[model samples]
Target: SQQGEEDPQALSIQEGENATMNCSYKTSINNLQWYRQNSGRGLVHLILIRSNEREKHSGRLRVTLDTSKKSSSLLITASRAADTASYFCATPISNFGNEKLTFGTGTRLTIIP
Candidate 1:
């Protein structure tokens, strides 16, 4: 399926701490994206790191992609209670001329205050 699978299905950390999650995929991809969902809310795009790029940062969020390992990692520094959410990693799959995103098994993160 080439779908990514996130490790540590669930995680809990104190506020102001850092949170990290890992995602592993079965096949090669051009880029990977991270998304966050807060409870009943929809998924919000966090970051995207391309295969050619080793690392990228957006605000307090840092994303790293290792093409050789077929894996990616997401880091949220100084996490807050508001950061509590389910995080998913997505990879694009091309079928014919169309492209769609396939998501990973999410990691539920709880930031304790």
Candidate 2:
């Protein structure tokens, strides 16, 4: 039931600038993941960081997690016009015998040319 929520409902920036997004969750999670979705397209998994991990990076994407604060942040460096998309944070929910993943509302990022 709505585990995470992303900050900055929407973001706009120039092509060469950097973009940063944040997420906060209500309950404990085993892992947190980031995803990107282009307009009218499906999502692409970006990175996943375990609860024990503080930070992780893949290519131009960097993610940091703070379990104590129940928050996570995603940073995209050297943003390009093609980077315009919606980013979301996801967390797994385990209750009784039902287990599934819940996604945050998402942050819409627009990279201007």
Candidate 3:
């Protein structure tokens, strides 16, 4: 089964404000990955943090993982209007079948001008 669910199906904030989102999963996993997709563009890998790790950062983005609680969080600091995009959490699934990842529905983030 898939292992993660992001909170707040949608979010809106003025440009330059930080945006925060949460994710919760249901099963044990090898790793967690985050992605961003802009309209008409393909999903882009944002960052990847292994299960053995707790937190990771990339540029203005910060991510935290809690194995015990089966949850993760992503934070985009000083967000810009151009930062508007859909964010998704990917939990690595078992080798069962050929499935490599189970992606959550995702959170729609809108950065207001």
Q: All candidates' lDDT scores?
A: 0.94, 0.94, 0.90
lDDT of 3: 0.90
* Model 3: worst 10 consecutive residues (lDDT sum): 92-101
Estimate, for each residue in 15-106, the C-alpha lDDT of model 3 and write its tens digit.
89999999888898778899999985899999998999999999999999999999999999999998899999999776767758888879
Q: Estimate each model's TM-score.
A: 0.97, 0.95, 0.93
Give, for candidate 2, the lowest lDDT window spanning 10 residues. Answer: 92-101
lDDT of 2 by residue, 1-113 (tens): 65688989999999989999999999888899999999969999999999999999999999999999999999999999999999999999886879888999899999999
After superposing candidate 3, which stretches have Cα over 4 Å from the reference?
Answer: 96-99
Error of 3 at 31 (Å): 1.0
Q: How much lDDT does candidate 2 score?
A: 0.94
Deviation (Å) of 94 in candidate 2: 1.2
* Poorly placed runs, candidate 2 (over 4 Å): none
Candidate 1 has an lDDT of 0.94
**lDDT tens per residue, model 1, 1-113:** 77789988999999999999999998878889999999969999999888899999999999999988898999999999999999999999888979999999999999999
